[model samples]
Target: MSITSANQLELLQTAEAVAREKMIDPSLVIEAMEESLARAAKSRYGAEMDIRVDIDRKTGRATFTRVRTVVEDEELENYQAEFTVEQAKQYMSDPKVGDTFVEEVPPVEMGRIAAQSAKQVILQKVREAERDKQFEEYKDKVGTIINVLVKREEYGNVIVDLNPGEGVLRRNEKIGRESYRNGDRIRCYIKDVRREQRGPQIFLSRTAPEFMAELFKMEVPEIYDGIIEIKAVARDPGSRAKIAVISYDNSIDPVGACVGMRGSRVQAVVNELQGEKIDIIPWNEDQPTFLVNALQPAEVSKVVLDEEAGKIEVVVPEEQLSLAIGRRGQNVRLASQLTNLDIDIMTEEEESARRQAEFEQRTKLFMDTLDLDEFFAQLLVSEGFTNLEEVAYVEVSELLVIDGVDESTATELQMRARDYLEAQAAKALESARALGAEDSLIEFDGLSPQMVEALAKDGVKTLEDFATCADWELAGGWTTVDGERVKDDGVLEPFDLSLQEAQDMIMTARVLLGWVDPADLEPDAEELGDEEAASEEAEA
Candidate 1:
């Protein structure tokens, strides 16, 4: 191959076409072409010579040049890279060291290898520019939907063609059992954009709950207009879904707006989802009401909420039990996710039986612990006394609520409860002490009397021993109990601590033992102590 005046037009035309095809700026293509030409010119100029190339972006004409730095004789490293002052003086009258001299050279005759090298340079630059463009375009578009064409499927991964470039839809992001064919147009949310060695990766997803929410935003005008908001969504993909919606405008019913007129709006979404059934429910501020709404189409006779435990018990009629639980617990599971509460569903008959058994158990407990007759125990149980702890903690005024239990009887029962608790606590503390437990360990804030006893038995009998214990060990580490892994729940049932709480207790123990500076613990403890001492002295 050879370059001539006639073929310069062809070079310019080829550069433009390649730039357009590769989605790169034409200037970059021209620069790449020049660099490739310079490399080829190097073969003739001598490999050690510094060669450069410049191409006109407008006219597609190429120019060759050689660059050398002017240097003193002793500073010259290579004769080809640097021109001594004597040689430089011939080109310029006042040549100075560190000055660069660029001399124009005739264009090289294009060769087979030279053309191929130029082509590779242009292709490499174009690819880099394309990746940069893809990254910039899609980085800010993550969490938003984009239209794509299914280019092909490779090992269960779908190759999607976007307007910018080709993207990947990994198998994990695909909805369960959803299938795609080549040339099929689809809509997905841009989950992430990552720059890798090959190119920028734009990941698409159809399974994210956020993706489902975006679809609703597109389909529901109310949601887009901010008249309604999607609080949450739970999907059993390709089967069923539940969405919770709330309306900011009083006049607009959020659920009705999402469902559209005669189900047109929801049906549109359903059609796009391949006939996935959707239940749009109105959100409520009251969690119990919201939970009931989340589990729709099932008649809930009653809902018992235990907010502290994050659990809700729903009792339905015997005939509606299956419906409430759904086929394989789907309905209840979705409801739990939407409401952020664990749900337990039972039949009305089952709830009644449970209540009766609880009543008998509590009545018997009162009889044994309070030494009360059957009638009095029954009255105490009816008045909401479940265990000896409640009897020991309840106020005298509350005990008076029971019929035939006058102030005298209430006072006597309260005395007995206090005596029992004190006796039990003293026994635990004495046992802890007898087992070589330090007073500091026995009196730690978070450690119960029974926990101190247990620690003593385990040879952790001092403040240092308590501080060194792990959160899991302090809270009753996992132990095999009746073929099940259960935490020790401390030296006694219900004396469990969270990991953070246990860590805090350890820090407190360290501070008390002078292992940690009190100043560092609270920053003002020393000052506060001084102020208190001064005040006491003044009072004295």
Candidate 2:
């Protein structure tokens, strides 16, 4: 064989080698070469001209040729149209006016340009095939952990060499506070598998949210078996993490299951995370309850939620404030992210102060005119009824039910209770009016001026009325406009009143005549009892 033929054989062998290395078919390489030659010929000649190339697969020898029609006169010089009828008949017996002929052009020397062009086509085809294969291989592997060998680092990012190709482990994907030496064996999740011009490019992350999820799945059998589910997780990698978990089986405690026996399951995950503290909180449908749980190890007393703003105010006991807020505010910070809430932490003292301020405004309403002392003054001191208005609305029955009162005394207390409440009702109306409450009188459902005068004439003028007034005064001593004795049925029944007949009549009259501010008339008996005791002591 000549030197030229040897070089041709070497070229064929090189193409085959490249195809095998790239996992592409050898025929694809030949196709790529044919395409490259066709393009080169077209660029040199024109699209109107027909071009063809033939290659001996075994010998790696190639020949290029052009085909054209044989015309009577050479209208176009480059036509290669020479052929007598006799000679044309040699190839085709039925030669006619439009007879075509194949003219073999001498093989052009494969110059540097042609060789470069062929190399590019072969490389491009191989890359495309490899990319297609890689995409199919990795697309399904997302959300899974894959072990990749560290190949090199570029621009401060680790490049992982996989079985077939290379992937990227960007700096951000690297776990914070973790150091990686060259050739270090590290496990990471395939965050994403994307295709690029070069080949299949995988994105790996050691700090992804799913990383913890996957770790938990591996460590906790409950998670793997579907008994428990990790709803969401937030982490400050290498430091702390918060994960919300829920159990499908109500019989199983989700948090405890996730925690494993003696925390063995969770401890394994924590070890993998380099001792990162994990708070596995039970997931709750109620936002407030979920948030409170999210701030683990910190006891929460109350949660005020502003769902629209994604904000929550958590009140904790003064001693637990630091614990709830966590060291350097990490507890609340993680809670916020886990529950998707903007959290504000408050101590018990702050909450107390807030309650006090609210009480002051509510009490200022009827403290002056109504002699709240008869019912609430002693009770307030005894039971801590800081707010007077809260006391005015107490139910007489509940007050009578307290430890010290007897049934008979409670009965007497009940009769005068409505009068005491009516006075407070009038005061609340005046307060509402002062505060610019529109149609304040309309707000007071049934109380009228005539009702108030009749109640007063019956010695029911103040909140003290029911507690101080004689039974006859409350029953029938007062008269109606027609001069008929006012029936006991017309008076408001004490909550302790057992007779349904009498209670209904009084309640109906109050509702019809508008004798009380609906707001004030509904007293919290607990508060009223407390205030009443306070009032008695003050008087003593």
Candidate 3:
């Protein structure tokens, strides 16, 4: 193939056709042609010479040129592509070292091998441009639901046509046991879009919880209009799912609206999910109240929530236990996901037994530590005084309210409790000092003697060591590892230290050691206060 004057316009026509077929910019195809021509020119001319090609966008004319750069005699390397500045006087009045000399050169004829090589180069560039265009077209479609035509199946994965590109629905991302044939229309969630060496990969999913939520948004006009909001969703693929919703308008019931008239709306979603049963629950600000609603179709006798641990205990009647837990604990599992809390379900009888065991344990502790008889200890426990600290530090008037307890008896009880606690503290202090604890830590006002002992055992024996500790290290926290929350035990966690309290104590220690400036924290505190005030106002 040669760039003949008669067929020069054919180049522009070919570039336009290729660009239209690939749905890419025509200029990209022309650029690829220019590069291919340049490569052929280099092969025809001396390999060391710098050959270039320019294609006119409108006229389709190809111009070829040979360029030689002027350089110092000592720096010149390629004799064909570079010339000495002194030798460049023939081409220019005053040539600089960086100047280039250009002369018109005839275009090279593409032989059989060269034509094949140029074809590959154009194909490579066109493919790259096509991939880039596909990536840009689909990247913003992530998290959206789209209808696609199923192209074919590779192994267990289904490839779908996105009109301009193809998406793969991985086996794991499909609804349980779902299968499709070629040309089947399927609705899927655009989970991800990535650009790879081969091409742009669009990952589609039918099992995502977001798919369910989006379906409802499409079906329910209130949700689409922001009158009702889906707070959370959890799905078991083709089995069962749960969704929590809230209504901003008081007149609109979120659950009722989602259920639709006579179950039409929810039934549509359920049918799309292959009959996946869905439980629509109302959203609540109170976690325990919300959890009680989440565990539907079962009567809950009580709900005990541990906020710090993100756990809850639900007590139900014995007959309702099976219903609350559902088949293979599915109900409780879905409820846990919906509420974002670990749930422990038990019969009412189990709760009673557990309460009895705790009451007896508290009674025994009072009897052993306070020199009280069994009856007196039980009475104290019944009066809600569980520990020595409560008994020792409680107001005298509170003790006087107890049966058969006057001022004198109250005084005696407090004295005994205080004595025992002081002895325990002194023993802990002695042990901490034995473990190389310093007076600097012992004198820290926020830490208890038992806390000092615990710190000493953990090799944190000085105030400086405590100041260097992270808040989570002293207050404990939950960490997400491999999609599961694991507990990170803290040195001071056993003493009921909260994260905020630990942070404040550590900052105080740092200030005392002159390791931190108080003024540096003032701006942060003010900003936090302002943010909190704004949040409260918005809530109101």
Error of 2 at 406 (Å): 27
Ranking by TM-score: 3, 1, 2
Q: Estimate the overall C-alpha local distance difference test score of candidate 1.
A: 0.83
In candidate 3, which residue pairs get closer than 3 Å at backbone N, Cα or C atoms, i.e. clash? Answer: none
The lDDT values for all models are: 0.83, 0.68, 0.92
Candidate 2 global TM-score: 0.56
Q: Model 2, stretches more than 4 Å misplaced?
A: 1-17, 25-28, 40-109, 195-201, 250-253, 361-540
**Candidate 3: segments with Cα more than 4 A from true spot:** 68-90, 93-101, 509-519, 524-536
Rank candidates by lDDT, best first. Answer: 3, 1, 2
Candidate 3, residues 326-397: lDDT per residue as tens digits? Answer: 999899989988998888999989999998998999999988888889898888989898788999999999
User: What digit string (tens of lDDT, one per residue) describes model 1 on residues 264-342?
Assistant: 8998888877788888999999998998898898988899997644578998999888888898889988888788777
**What's the lDDT for candidate 2?**
0.68
* Tens digit per residue, CA lDDT, model 2, 462-489: 4333334344333332334442223344
Positional deviation of 54 in candidate 3, in angstroms?
1.5
Per-residue lDDT value at 206 in model 3: 95
TM-score of each candidate?
A: 0.77, 0.56, 0.93
Worst 10 contiguous positions by lDDT, candidate 1:
484-493
